[model samples]
Target chain A: MSDLDLLKYTCGRTDLSLICDLIDPGSSVLDLGCGDGLFLRYLKERKNVRSLGLEISAEKIASCIANGVPVIQGDLDSRMEFAADGDFDYVILSRTLQEVRHPENLLDEIVRVGKQAIVSFINFGYFEYRFELFFCGRMPRGRHLPYEWFNTPNIHLGTLTDFHTLCRERHIRIVSAEPLGRIHGILPKWCWPNLFAHSCVFVLEKEK
Target chain B: MLLIEPQNYDFGPGEENALELDCRKKLYEVTLRYETCGKLNADRSNAVLIEHALSGDAHVTGYHTPEDRKPGWWAEMVGPGKAIDTDRYFVICSNILGGCSGSTGPRSIDPATGKPYNMNFPVITIADMVRAQKRLIDHLGISKLLAVVGGSMGGMQVLQWMIDYPDSVAAAVPIATTAQNSAQNIAFNWVGREAIISDPKFDGGNYDPENPPGKGLSTARMLAHITYLSDETMGRKFGRNLQENDHYAFDFRRDFAVESYLQHQGRRFVERFDANSYCYITRAIDYFDLADRTNGDLAAAFHSAKGKFLVVSFSSDWLFPTKQARALVKALLANHLETNFCEIQSGYGHDAFLLEIDTLGAMVGAFLANTLNEVSSGKQRGAQS
Candidate 1:
């Protein structure tokens, strides 16, 4: 069974399943910032997809090797020199977009290497973040944003509407957008996603 | 703390054991010094080949005796209950073809001439070293190796092994090495070689048998030692601190602690290493470029290599940095081979593999165990079917 199928049986989170659903079986995958290769292992076992992973930590790379996952140690901020153009069917950057040096450049490289890219990140413009900034007068620290102000990797945090603008700006076609959490899932189509969504996932491909 | 002694295996019959080097010059009657800690299994499937880097010999681990000062070059990693684990796998480490220790090199007496080969020694390459080891393996009656593990120049041999005899290797761990020697690495080695050559006592690598080129060889080692350590590590170690004094001596004597350290290291190195072998080995390493060998197509070089690969590099190693390792990984991935690459963050530079034993041990140990299991499982399936 694939990770999606396993998660389905185990009552796992909806967002993870949604991301797996976006990918077709037996497709080539490149997972950026693949810590411990958890998702790649799942994809390999369930979807039977050809997968490669890039991570930065040595310990995590060892773990990936131990699990028989082909992983390369590299920083996400650097250009995708190892990955060839259109080499992968799907490039995943789940919860890593906010931590990247330049999200737009990274997304461009991702879409260049992969036919499509699945980017999932915690929405900075969400109600709780706004509440923390407004009421608490500090950077948000909750379930989604668990890190402290100094150590948090979320440098370029954006919301769903900002992503829509980015997609339009870059002439990228949005295949699908899935919102997660109690507030984000129930938001009306006409309403602003900035105020509702706690976390969001967007699958994008070039207009061509 | 437990030291083990190494046993030598000498075998040669002139032309019968001839090795043709890259330069097409055949070296006959070669003496390969080797040591095996663990026993060979019934099927000989659990044999691990450990290749040593430059300046390293067959004494990979274990002391000559209980009271011996140094156990081995890689004493920390390849011992009983250690990363290599003599308890599980039969480990074999041999001195390269052109090395000083007990191997036949420039210092060895040529059977035909009845004198040390010296300048007459055949110019050997990394591939030549692997070819020599292949003979040793055949003599041991081991058809296949569980894994070929090494760092730096040793890693070059691992790459040569995979490409030369792909079917013979099940897995490879090439740490702190590139697919080929970079221009910078070549340039650094060139400077070290120049140090030895420019010495007045070098005498065209045909120095007097009684007293070799000490000054030149020591100077060459001192220059090469700088490349092994990072600036940060050097600073942490010595940082301009005066040697045996609170202030500068303002004379020709070794002023800084770093200078004294280098002098000590250089002086100690010349005693064990042969200057002529240094020239041959460095030249051999400089000539190592797998890409050039395959007409600039690196991925195609591994066309027949079906083994799993683990390529490692140190972050601070400017000589064999992460960039080089990543390029190798990229080529392997391009060939659609199973590969794992990791750039370990360390203050130690190119010498991290030798220095950082804890992390290196665990990583190598885990990788070896996983490979051993896969090989056994495949054999089991083959037998049952």
Candidate 2:
């Protein structure tokens, strides 16, 4: 099945729709770590956007080409020298922030290459994870953070507040921050998002 | 199965029509050998040019006759319903300018002397080859080719086509190639040239046509053929197996199957290939540094190009490694060109461009379809504007 069709079946499972909604129609997009190019393909089909992807896997790059999404095979952690300043309207780093070696350096690169950046990650300070770690004295295991501490790809995991602080420290303005709790869907306005939200999406731009 | 005939196109008896080579000499009475498959559509935007590699020829796909033992070099990717799909696009493959396959090369009779040009043939570059091809395309009334595709040396030509005539090409696929011939590659070419020049019978490239430098040319071909295959494939195919005996022949005879296999390749190459042509062609390849004209800025070299690109490499192709392809892709990306790159998983080395048919076919086929769609839609938008 096409990635659009697949997205329809699993629309409620993740923040792909949230990220897609944030991007304006007909905007140019650069998706980092765009696995199988599904999200870029989604942008191309639904929003009629000019989309490209940077992926390290040859297999995934081939899949992107086969699906008619322009992509360059490259490591996300390496210097993205190929991308010119403000070449893309949106540079989406969905669920790939924590996996990168240096999230701060990558965020700087994304904002430099794109006018706006959309970052999504699993919030580490969710109340259930806090309770588990507090009571059991073990590396927290939740739906998103499934792997053991020794094997998990998420090396630099952080909470929603941590992301806000990083943006503040880096002189980046947060355009919007959406916190979605798995149990209650959109987190209640009364609830503290850092403690209650399961995952979060942040739209950021570099301060002038 | 289609039976195709190779066609000859000639240009230049006049000084104005003569092609000026990179070596600062004019070449006259040039001939380009070419073959075409499928019909050119009314709009003529469906034409695809296929450039041949160092050892390849004009015949790209289809049989010359019913009794022919084999098809063209890229038959697996250019037939009906194949990756290039001759059924859908009008495909053209031409023998390069400095090639032996009926093209005007060192082997062709010199117009002035009425003998083989031999060493007298002005050294040509990849750009010169593309310039000759431009004449043929003009003669065929194709204003712009839908795509230009090639592998190895052929890929160099494809890059030249994109850069030289940016508006004339809609898309390009350069596979298993590098923009600049690496130093190691130049060393390999130098050794091959030395092999041909040092032969006793070569006699400064004036050897009798009937008694050419067979041994030296064969040895050069053997060395090159080794570069085209991976150690994994070599081990899988030969694996130290004896050619005819269970025990090793301690003397310098062909004992290993790999030795005999290389011997067969060399012998077969010497029969159809010209030693002088090899020298000129390999020299052309060695001189192919795309960034030389742009002050070593690779991206600036493609500043005017406006074509979609698909750059492919094989994982095991050390001769033109994936890193070189990556560098080329990085330059294209820096230009903000519509570029797609993939290093295919294969154990066949540089020859994987020809051998890895299924995966390569699927990718090319889809990319071609996408390009056609985008280009046509763009034309429609232009029309409305």
Candidate 3:
């Protein structure tokens, strides 16, 4: 692939851009499953945020190193090597929640490490996906969920409401719940986002 | 800017001799050196210490004449107005103990033997590295540090400082590192060591000065370098791309660009780094079990530390994953120490901290500024009270 194509393949996603915009510039950040270190590099340059990436791939870690980004190759399910107690201002899980086997435990870990955790997931409850399930009787495929079911990394598919309910059940305080869609080239409203939006971004905190 | 070349200058009388440190039965000699820039003032609390990674030198940031080929590895972050802000902070980077970069290492002539210690050099741990740093700090007469920051093996030294001499550091930033090496990590190190020793030219860790263990060391570095990156990054950058044309050459020559790149990295590294030092340093990293040393409690290691900490990790970095950073947060919480953790979303793998300058720099700058403010205000309140 060309350099531009590689860059686009690694980055060039609207959801990442939106998430980057929402994050406070100077806040400490931890990006889980940060692919190719693009978003972290973006946040570092534009926002001046101290960031770390936790990826599971060796090649990505090398690229991060080549680019001079700080990264660690590790699984999210295991105990981290970082020294204990609320070490980060924010821990971000972008486009990685669904792929994890036990997201609830991961969320608990995120809340434990950061004061606030921003989790962005593709909303499977969106009308287009629902229509695909009802009409075609198969899993939906779109810009967000591009891969076929067999080859897809997304294992834990859930809707906006389902995530909201899970957060409430787990006593996770919803700092902000917003929906995202390509509207005349802008993000749409948070409420009834499933109707018009393709994805949901949830900024949550552990309820004391 | 006035360029200073301390390496070219001869050390004043007795400076060349190594100072012995006898800790009971353990005897070790620390080789001390310093490079001062601008003025040497006691009131200027802007002193910053840059701890180099394994096989790194004292040169933190600078370009040695264009033809010299090798530029400072961190030249991007440590310039006048750069993220490290050399104008504001008096940066002091040193080659660590057990390192080949002008510091005490296996190659140094042992005072007792009169010959190079070779593999017979005392096995030093991360704590030993920090202990040597403490001596350097004491000799410099810098009572408190503005910040102690490092990545990978350097990050391990940063952690050791916080644990060993808590009061000396004001802020600690350990990026893209683990508190201790795991079994898998140890295995990787072992493989690299074996690769070096298995080489015919290694000569039992004392390869001839003319022809050192270049082949094996390069191969070891190539293998280790591969582990430092992510699959996605490699796929995106190299992606089975051929070196010269579309078709792969059937011969043993590097068929893919990635293979060529690895070969280049390995060859370049062998030119600058020593083979034996790699074996010793990797062993030190494997023996670095901070929790075990602190009685199976990582929190206890930082219990007495009063300074604020910034632990950073990168997403997609499997070598030192976000979970390790989270465990650090948990330990710090248990200790009730003021801390901030950030997992930057980066696909840069283990090297994200060095690459993602915008995020890491900003976060470090802001965190340091805030912590310094807190420290000043607390001192002010105490004075008023």
Identify the runs in model 2 with alpha carbons over 4 angstroms from their true place.
Answer: A1-10, A24-27, A45-48, A84-86, A101-105, A128-156, A161-175, A183-185, A188-190, A205-208, B379-385
Residue-level lDDT of model 1, residues A1-208, one tens digit each, is 3545566642544556677777899998988988877778777776878888999888888788777677888888889888788988999988888888888888788889999998886788888889989998998898777899889877887777788898788888988777666633534545556777787788888889
Please provide, for model 3 over A122-159, each residue's C-alpha lDDT reduced to its tens digit, 9 standing for 90 to 100.
Answer: 88888899999999999999878898999998999998
Top of the candidates by lDDT: 2
Q: What TM-score, computed on C-alpha atoms, does each candidate reach?
A: 0.91, 0.91, 0.65
Q: Per-residue lDDT tens digits of candidate 3, residues B1-385? A: 3353434211112433333332222434546444444343355455667777766777766654545555566766676777777766777777777778777777777767888877877777788777777777877777777678888888888888888777777778888888877787898899999999999999997777568898899999998888788998899999989999788678998889999999999999898888888898998889887797678788777777666677888888888787777777667656655455667788889877668887777666655555445444554111111
Measured by TM-score, how close is model 1 to the native structure? Answer: 0.91
Of 1 and 2, the candidate ranking higher by DockQ = 2
Docking class of 1: medium
Is 1 or 3 the stronger prediction by lDDT?
1
Off by over 4 Å in 1: A1-12, A125-141, A147-151, A183-197, B1-17, B379-385
| Candidate 3 runs further than 4 Å off | A1-208, B7-29, B33-44, B64-70, B376-385
- Please, what are the lDDT tens digits per residue for candidate 2 over residues A33-102? 9878877877777798888898888777768887778988777787777777898999999888989899
Cα lDDT listed for each candidate: 0.84, 0.89, 0.74
lDDT of 2 by residue, B1-385 (tens): 6899999999998999988777778989999999999989888878999999999999999999999999999999997889999888999999999899989999899999999899998889999999999999999999988899999999999999989998888999999999999998998899998999999999999999789999999989999999999999999999989999989778999999999999999999999999999999999999999999999999899998887899999999999998899889878877778899888889999999999998888878888887777666674122111
